[model samples]
Target: MTRVVFAPDSFKGTIAAADAARVLAEAWASVDPGVSPVLRPMADGGEGTVAAFAAAVPGARRMPITVDGPAGHPVDTAWLLLPASDDAPDGTAVIDMASTSGIELLDELRPWDADSRGFGQAIAAALDHGVSRLVLGIGSSASTDGGTGMLRALGARFLDARGAETAPGARGLGDIASADLSALRPAPEVRVLTDVTNPLTGARGAAAVFGPQKGLTDPSDQQQTDAALERLARLLALDPAVPGSGAAGGVGAALIAWGGTLLPGAAEVAHLIGLADAIAAADAVVTGEGAYDGQSGDGKVPSFVASLAAASGVDAVLVAGLIAPDADLAPFTASASLTEVAGSPASALADTHRWLHEAGRRLALAMRGSGPASGS
Candidate 1:
């Protein structure tokens, strides 16, 4: 029997990683019932990070709580509570920024007003539960608030020139004259998971590179936000030049200020979910994401999985909702794209699971024909 491992990330805004893996497994099984499919859903510290953990870890509990949303409204969200183990006697808490202060929570872009306070509040809840370790996934943020809102929720103070507290979101970043950590809660050991490598305050930094997507379209606004982040970095004694400092609209810097460590999201998640072990034992490995583009080569799930497969001398296959026209698929032994299978982007997205099912069938047939599947 052929052993196959399916490890895929979520198709952002459409399918969860776990769901995608399950559907793909079903499709593969339909083609070759004798094939043994091993499902291993993946994430990159974004919206589905906690869910990925929940699917991979046994006895992981969801701790629901209400907190301030990105738009300053109360929103119900939950964090994951992983039972204590020998490595961590007090247990572990897994939190995702996208669940609390993410862009998906907003009806419309709040730009300067959206904040990460909700994300911080979730962290506080975990701290209150007496967790010894924190695994924070900072992705899909709604604001470029320099993480002020998050720090504030953890009992830190961001004051203006007059010693008064500033406003919320990026709107307050420009006014922050000082920061006080005296009242901040003692933070547990934090491991920040993210794929971004942008710095905090330049053309390639958070504001200049990501601000426009968060509704900071005007060049002046981007510059101002960048300057504000620079000021915040100075006030907090942080090095803005560090890689990953700009993740989640500067929330990366904020977490670091709180004594957190940063690591690649894909690699970290892969390790946590035991992807390496699964891949090593599999006859073939399959991986994918929402879109395969130039950016996907940079620390994304597909590329990471492909590299792992290559290291293990195993054939790797890729399945994507949409493959960019110029994306290089050399890493994969075989590749299937929903866009090509469905004949149009809208059609593919309209019913993603159906298209994914077809993609899986095509991949299975292709692999069975060749000694090892070859990229199409």
Candidate 2:
């Protein structure tokens, strides 16, 4: 029996990574009943990070909670609790911003008003449960408040010149005259996961590189926002030039202030889920994400997984919802894009699973050096 590993990140607005892996596995099995398929869903500390942990960890449990979302509305979400071990005496709490306070939680961009408070609230909840360590996935963040909203929820106080609490989100950044970290909760061992390495306040920094995506496009606007973050960094006594400090619109810097360590998101997730060993033993591996482009080569899910496969001399197959026209497909032995298979981008996204199923079938056949069977 040929062993094949199926690993796919969430399809962005459509299927989850776990669901994508399942769908691809089923499609492969339909084509080759003798094929052995292993499902190992992947994430890059983004939206599907928690779900990926739930699938990979043996005894991970979901702890539900309600917290204020990015749009200042209540959101029901869950954090993952991994059973205690010698390495982690009091167990581990896994929380992701995507479910807690991510940009996706808002109907529209709240560049100035969206906050990371919900993410901090969830962390506080996990801390209340007495977890000794934390694994925070701070991707898809909604605000550029320099993480003041999150720090506030964790017991830090951000006050204006008059000694009054400032407004929430980036809107209040300019008003923060002082921050009181005296009341902040005691630090627990924290590992902040993110693939971004942008600095905190310069040209390649958070406000300049990512602020535009969240609606702070003008150079003057980004400059002002960057200045605010710079001010916060000075107050907190953390370096603003450190790589990855600008991730999630300055949440990374805030976590650093809270005594957490920054680590590569995809690499960490891959290690936690044991991707290397699995790939070494498999004949071939398949990995994918929503979009594959030039940037995908730089620390993204597909490239990381493909690199592992290559190290083991295993054939790696790449599949994606959409493959940019100029994207280098050299990492994989073969590749498929839902957009090409489904005719149009709209058609692919409208019924993503259908196209994914088709892509899986096509890839499975291609692996066998065979053409499609009949109309399949």
Candidate 3:
């Protein structure tokens, strides 16, 4: 009887992390009835981050706010606030960038001219409500103005060479030559949760990795994004070369400049959930996400699980919707093996449950060194 643990992030539109794990366990039980499976639903400080943190800290409260979504529509955004303890008078609050500015909210790849000003507005509101400690999840954002829009919403004025406040769009970013934060206020404590280590500028920056996804596929769009990033980075006095600075459309740059400490998103989640401790007791651990590849190495779900499994001397296996052909799984191979869910990526994406069952049966067969009987 193998002691297995299933810790996986959501498969995006297919299934929630918890449900996915449950399905995997069901499939595993079909092949090996005695196998024990532990479930740990996870996220990477983007979507569903608030729920994850709330699970870790029950003292946290969920507050709703109407903020601008990817389509510039008002969305019922939520953030987590930790209740004050005896030592701390005010509570700690967390702002998920995805809640206010994620690409998932967009219906189609429309050219968005607006900046991240909406995010700043949301944070400021959280502060006004007596949150002394603020945690910002800086990934899955839609803007690329180096967080200038967020700063503007937070009371920092961005001015053009003509000494006029820039407009609240992409065009406005190009004219920004300076920024004034004297009128702004901030919480005593602020931290940014980032999943990547790319800098705020240059070839390895936001424009390179995430720009295309944001509908900035053309040269003109890329140049515009680059220009906006340049202006914002200069205004913030950031090196523009710091790792993780480009995350969340350069929200990482602004937050860091605003005194926000950056931490690995998956690591933070793992620590909160005692992932290492859980892995230490398991014989086999299963981990995965929507897609697994080199990008997963940067504090993504599977990579983090693999790391924990390694520390515990347990074997980890990755099951994903699609495994990139060129993906270097060696890092996960140290303690885990990668496996595709179905016949092809498209098929798996179409039917997650079917693929999960296939994966679970494979895992069971691998463990027992035998296949299941027909219809048994």
Candidate 4:
């Protein structure tokens, strides 16, 4: 009997990762009745991180804390505590960057004119919860202050060249010429989980890769943003050229400076879920996310899972909502295949189940070597 493991990230607006896994599991059961299927939902420490963790680890506790959304409003967010120290009783807490400062929350609160004050508060709350190690999922953030607000929430201060406190948003990023970490008060054990490796400065840095998303327009101002990031780094007494420094608006940089270790978000979570063991034991491993493209290769959940499966001598397949040109991930996995659902992008969004089933049938047939000539 074939042992298949289905691990998929959320399909974004379409389906949850668990639901996607169910769809794949049902497909495999229908095609190969004897196959044993394992379902594992994955996340990049972004939007569904809390749900994914809650599903994987029982006794996970959740507490609501107000944090700065992308635009700087007090959005009600959550901090999840898992099995940790004896004093806390609850496990280590999972601090979702998204919960406090995600794009969705930003949109709801109009983040363009806001700051990240609440994000800082959320982190402080986690520390107060007696969390042994704070797992800061630094993705899907709404702020472009390079985590200035996040640092502020932890007691770090951003000062301008004139030595005045800067406002807690990107607009004031240009004036930031220094940082003061002497007053910072973060937990002793903190790990930042991020997918991006871009630095906090330069052309490939935060302002370049993510500024536009936060409504930055002037190319000249990008340099200022980079400078602001560097200033923060200097305040923390560290180098800003570190990889992942640009993640979540430079939270990675702030975390590193503040004694937080940086880790690959998806890979770390996968380890927490015993993904490698599952891959080693499976006859075939299937992984995917909301979308697949060149970016997926950069330590994204699907690509990371593919890499693990390949190392374990397991064949893998990628099934995604949208398949871009470089989304053909077979090149990276030793014996991998890529398949997309049928229907236009809009149709797929409108009727997710139909195409998810279609995609599943197509994948199942491919696995059995009886699939059609083309997915088109």
Candidate 5:
């Protein structure tokens, strides 16, 4: 039997990684009954990180909680608890911004107003549960508050010049005077996860690189927030030049200040889920994301997966919701785009499951040498 491993990141807003993997596997099986499809959904410590862990680890448990959302409203969510192991006797808790203070929770973008308090609240809950280790995925945050809101939630106080707490989110960055972390919960052994590697300040900083996407359109607003974050870094005695410090709107730096280590999200998740071993044993590995663009080569799921496949002499195949014009597809044995298959971006997103099946069938056929050319 031909062994194929299906490992794909969540399709962002369209589909969860586990569901996508299941759909793809079923379609591939239908197309080629001789194929042994292994479903191994993946994540880069983003939106579906906890769900990915839950699916991969048999004894993983979900601990439910409600916390302040990005828009300052209560949002119900949960953190994942991986059962105790020798490395982590008390268990490891998985928390991420995507399910807590994530951008998707907002009705609309509130670059200056959306705070990361919810993310911090979730972390605090995990800590209270006595998890000895933390795997924090600091991605998809809605705020650019330099992690102030999160710190506040963790018992660190960001006070104004008048000795009062500053307003929430980026809107209050300019009002900071001093910080008091004495009452803050000391961080346990923690590993912060993210695909981003930008520094905390300057041209490639959080404010400069991701501000616009979060709706910080005005040049003046970006400048102010950037300055504020730089000041915060100085106040907390953290280095602003640290790579990955700019992740999740300065949450990376904040975690560093709280004594957490930053690690590559995709690589960490791969190790956690035993992706490398699976690829080594498979004839081919298929991986993808919601969008494949020039940025896909940078520590992303598809690129990382392809590299592993190459080292193991396993063919790597790519499928994506959309492949930008400039995306380099050199590492893939074959590639497919749901947009091209569905004939439009809207339709593809509207019905991702259907196109995913089609993509899987085409990929299986290509491997069998009975399908037309693979692009799209």
Candidate 6:
């Protein structure tokens, strides 16, 4: 029997990683009944991180809570509660910033107003549950507030020149004069999952590199936010040049201030999900995400899986929602693009499951050496 490991990340706005794995497994099985598929949905501390853990870990529960969202409204969201294990006697809380403070939560980009308060509120809720450890996924952020809003929610005070608290979001950062962590809630052991390595301020830092995406397109705005974050780092006695300090619009720095350790999201998730072991025993490994582009090579799921497969001497295949024209697919044995199979990006996204099924079949056939040439 051919053993195939199905490890895929969420396809953004389309399919969740767990559902994508199931669909891929079904599709592969349909093409080759003898094939043994191991499903391991993946995430890089992004939008689907919580869902990935919930899908993979038995006895994981979703604890729903309402918090202020990025758009200044209450949003009902949930965090993952993993059952007690040898590593954590009281259990672990998996919180994702994307659920509360992500760009997706905004109707239209609120560059200056979007804040990480909602994310912090979620963390506070998890802490209240008495989780022994925290697994925080800080990705897809909507604000550049230097995590001041999050700190505010956690009882840290961000004061202006007159010793008054500032407003929320990035706009408030410029007014901050001091920070007080005296009243902050005591943080438990925190493991931050993030792929970002930029610092809190600089040319390659948070505001400069990520502000545009969060709607801080103006050069002046980016510079202002960057300066604010620099001030925040100084006020908190944090190293602004630390790797991952810029993650989630300076949420990384905030977590560090609260005694959290930063970890590579993809590798951490892989270890947690046992992807290495699964790949070792598999005949082939398949991985993908919403888009396979030049940037996907940077510690993303597909590249991470490819490395694992290579180490295990197994072939790695990729199935992407859309493969960029300049994407380098040289690491994969074969690759398939949903857009190519479905004929259009719109059609592929509209029916991701169906097209993904087709992609799976194509991959199965390719593995058996009976399909057409595969390359995107």
What Cα-based lDDT does every candidate model obtain? 0.91, 0.91, 0.74, 0.74, 0.91, 0.91
Q: Write the per-residue lDDT of candidate 4 for residues 12-52, one digit (tens) a residue.
A: 75677778788878877777889898877788877777767
TM-score per model over all chains: 0.96, 0.97, 0.85, 0.87, 0.97, 0.96
Per-residue lDDT tens digits for candidate 3, residues 1-376, read 6788878877777777777778878877898899888777677777766666665565778888888765567888777787885544688777777778777776775444646866787898888887777777766777666787788778889898888987765556677888899987764678677778888777888877788878778877777777778778877888788888989878888888988888888887777656778789988887777777667776688888887888778887777766676656664432212234454556777777877777767766765668531111
TM-score pick, better of 1 and 4: 1
Model 5 TM: 0.97
Off by over 4 Å in 3: 1-4, 29-38, 55-60, 83-90, 110-112, 326-341, 368-376
Model 6, 1-376: lDDT tens digits are: 9999889999998998999999999988998999888888999999899998988788999999999998789999999999998988899999999998899998999889999999999999988999999998998998988888888899999999999989899989989998988999998889999999999999999999999999899998899899999999999999999999999899999899889999999999998878899999999988999999999999999999999999989999999998998888988998999999998988998898999999988888888888863435
Worst 10 residues of 3 by lDDT: 332-341
Give candidate 4 regions above 4 Å deviation.
32-35, 85-90, 108-112, 159-164, 176-182, 331-340, 373-376
> How does model 6 score by TM-score?
0.96
lDDT of 5 by residue, 1-376 (tens): 9899989999999999989888888888998788887777888878889887888877999999999999989999999999998999999999989999999999999988998999999999999999989999888889898888889999999899999989999988888889999999989999888999999989999999999989998988899899999998999899899999999999999999999999999999888888899899999998999999998999999999999999999999999999999998999998899998888999899999999889888987887799853546
Local error of candidate 3 at residue 199 (angstroms): 1.8
Range of the 10 consecutive residues with the lowest summed lDDT in candidate 6: 367-376
**Candidate 2 Cα errors over 4 Å, as ranges:** 372-376
- How well does candidate 1 score on lDDT at residue 107? 97
| Reference-based lDDT, residue 49, model 6 | 94
Backbone clashes for every candidate come to: 0, 0, 2, 11, 0, 0
Off by over 4 Å in 5: 373-375
State the number of backbone clashes in model 5.
0
Model 5 scores a C-alpha lDDT of 0.91
lDDT over C-alpha atoms for residue 157 of model 4: 80
